[model samples]
Target: MFKSLLSDRPGTEPLAAAFRACRTHFVWAAVFSALVNLLYLAPTLYMLQVYDRVVPTGGLTTLGLITAVAVFALACLAILDWLRGRLLLRAGLRLDRMLSSRILARVVDIQARSVGQAPGSQALREFDNVRTAVSGPGALALFDAPWTPLYLGCCFLLHPAIGLLTLVGGLILFTLAWRNERDSRPRLAKAIQSNAAAYAAQESVAGQAEVVRALGMRGSSIARQIDQRRGAVAQQADAQLTGGKYSGAIKFVRLVLQSAALGLAAYLVVKGEMSAGSIIAASVLLSRAVAPVELLVGAWPGLVQARSSWNTLVELFAKTAAQDRSRTALPPPAGRLRLEGVTVRLPDTETAQLRHAVLGLEPGQTLGVIGASGSGKTTLARVIAGALVPTAGDVRLDGAEYGARDGDELARFIGYMPQSPSLFAGSIKDNISRFSSATGLEAAEVDRTAVAAAIAAGAHEMILRLPHGYDTALGPYGAGVSAGQAQRIALARALYGDPCLLVLDEPNSNLDQEGETALMAAILGAATRGAAVVVVAHRAGVLARVDRLLVMRDGAVQLEGPREEVLARLREAPPAMVAAGRA
Candidate 1:
């Protein structure tokens, strides 16, 4: 029955899997926590013994023995508490070891599928909240809460009236905590949303700082960010105020209950119905019984936040897990690229980005795609390189569907350069090698590949002229390099490892005439080496050597065939029409 219950809980399977991997530590920590709670009764028992047995009978030996036992119990309690903390720390570390990599990979996958629309950093932050909550004092308080009844039972043994009063106090505090959660949850959620909006605003401004400054839009942007931040702060303040009210009520009620229990016990003593020892013990036990409830009230906000974070992470994991289950491994591609009726539909519009784009290229074939701006050339390039999946139809390599292969593995054999080239904070060699150490490649092999790719891209001479040659480090986005230099180095990276498929988008956008010649040569060289090369460009000069041509307009192919035939057809068309097609 317990197994069935566990299986029925959402998110529990993954959580339990992690716990099982470190079950020994968890079990020991739990045992120690239980022992520590049990030892908590020692103080109350010692007070009862001293007041009733030692003081009444003047028994010094009895007092000495009781004191020694009380001290020993406390010492044991300290040791158990330390051990429990250590065990929990180890469990947290083990959980991180088991899940962090999987979570990070899933985040990357989510980002790719969403085309960077999703807030991946927020998702990662949520996961971190879950981990911290699991190892935090709030979790320990929750574990100890169940033992509240035991302490109350001990109070009942002292006197029924005291126990009943303590129970009522606990119920009141619990009610307050429930009210706090119910009232503040919506407010907290709104605050979180506002915070995210504020962060997004800041990120947008930061990314376009140069534009903001150039257009004198800094003031307006700052105002917008401030508005978002103000909303977030206001919502947070409201939530805290609501929670504080309930927290204050709980604390007041707890104090009253403790004093009332003591007063009632004293009244009973005066009436010869109870002893003084009973009063002291009853008060102590009542305090212990209600401590967990007090702790819960105080930590209630953080607990709620953690619960929300956990749910978000579970949803993300579930989505990623489904994707993983449907994916399969396939043999490496052999440069035979085919697109059968491929279509790409934008999420926010009715028009398709690419419509029934059917094309094929065998080994050693070079295809040049030319289109006007916003004619879907970049989209086609992305789809061909597997950066964006087609909305309809199939992308195949060697007669096998590209979707069948893992995305990362497929990416390894395909070289892609986007319109705006980007580089990480690494040396030129590392960028060209794609940071191959991450793939466990040896240093010598990485160096060989980097040097070869640089030469193939005609970047070797330029790179060598730099202060440190290939060892020179570049800042984010290839800082310290000219636009032409960055483009060539990016080309080098795309050509690395002699990938079977090459997709270059606007490869000459920032290149000089010399660099353009080098790029054209590189494309021809790739085709000669039995690679299937696809270049998307607006320049006719870049497409002069292509064996085939595809001219796209309005997301559909308007002209396609052998280069000579396409060029001949274009020549016969009106000059105005040809210019419009280019536009």
Candidate 2:
């Protein structure tokens, strides 16, 4: 833990900027706390001095005055302490807000493919770590720095010998705590990764509950996930326990040091080497000195955790958009998409998903891509839509290449819908509009378009049967909606954006006969409206209506021609069913 804190970049400028922004109020609050502590310290000194001097001299008047002043000081100290607490609380809240905003912006600015390509749970866990760092470590740092120095200075002024002793003890404790933190950090990071894997296991089982039950592996699957999670938690708990024991030992050292100082002071008073008043003042100061040490020891672990989280956030935000960094000075898209010898290989897969596969489409021309499972149809769509850059070759959108343009700049003209579509939690209208701020589209206008798109996708009748029409709430990832309905909602969203080119990857994969027919009509409708459309078709019903088709196999185009000729060829050569279901 000590190593983690010591190794971290001291005082990040972003955090410093946040501190400076709120420094005025925080400084005043620190001053108030210091004054309160001083006042609280004064009373012990006054009582001892008066007893040592005035009682022996029989001066009751001086005693009474000192007593009154002491009481007043105590009251003032209480009020100041209360005010300081309020100020610190507000300061913490503001720091949390600042960090939260910055982290959220960083997460959004990260490239979509970088996040999406990660194992789903790992990305989510990384975000959780970022949030914890912001709220947990960010707030603690604000309250700690001022208090440590304040009390340390007070101790020195009271008695330098005892002050040095206390400071040495604090240093020892801090070193021990730091070591513990450093040792625990790697374990904590490992636990976090393992827990993410366990979560993934649980989600996988839940998603395939029917299959698991059919195979009689429901109990085994759940048990395996739970056991894995338990093991991870146990490792984390062991690290925590070891760290706690070391922390406790540090606290014990503090107690012994404090006791020895008090004992020595009493012995000196008895031997007439030190005055009773001096003993009293030193004891008060000693207590103040220990306060910061105790607080620091307690806060060190949180600091390390936050640093670990900060590293994760940095890694997440460092991804360049569309996985390319060479492109500069982007040009406008001209609605034409050309895949010039494009190829992609899955990062962790041994086999290439695509290999130097070339294809192209002119402006306002629809091109349907057909392939067997693992034939790289969706990979081609991703490359064309500028979501994934090709491992080899380049995609040109009109005269300008995709690699030369920014992801957002290219995305404005090219829209894409994946085989498995995910939706946010909101009303149907909100999901359909994607919270876009385009000037002409309002909530009502989006609702109207959503309904039209749903009807075109053969989802309107099902949506109307729900509790509300377009106003209905779709739970997270459209949980309450059917698979087909979720697909329609995604299609609606993509259609509502009305991009120059639409790349739909197996859009009819989850649809029924009726739904497939409606979707095919919608594709034709989009083409009628001059929006170029490219679809990956498996069913014969949707394939028969397309203008042209390109057949893909083993990561390259096996055939390409007019739709009628391609269909005739496909009819003559039927692919195996098990080999054709990519999902």
| lDDT computed for candidate 2 | 0.67
lDDT per residue as tens, model 1, 126-149: 766766666777767877888999
Per-prediction TM-score: 0.93, 0.80
| Per-residue alpha-carbon lDDT of candidate 2 for residues 1-583, written as tens digits (9 for 90 to 100) | 1122222233234445555666765677758856765686676678576758886898988888888888888889888877776675666567566656554534443433433454222444454443344334333344444565556676566556666876787678768767777777787677666766787778878876778999999789878987998988887787678778777887788778778777767776787766777666666666665665566556655555556655554454344323334566655454676777777766667787778887767666677887777788888877776766666787777768765665555666776788787777887767776755344557667667677667655667767777887778987667778888888878877776567788888888788877777788778877776777888877756766678788878778777777767667766664652244212
In model 2, how large is the Cα lDDT of residue 100? 61
Best of the candidates, lDDT = 1
Q: Clash number for every model?
A: 0, 3
How high a TM-score does candidate 2 get?
A: 0.80
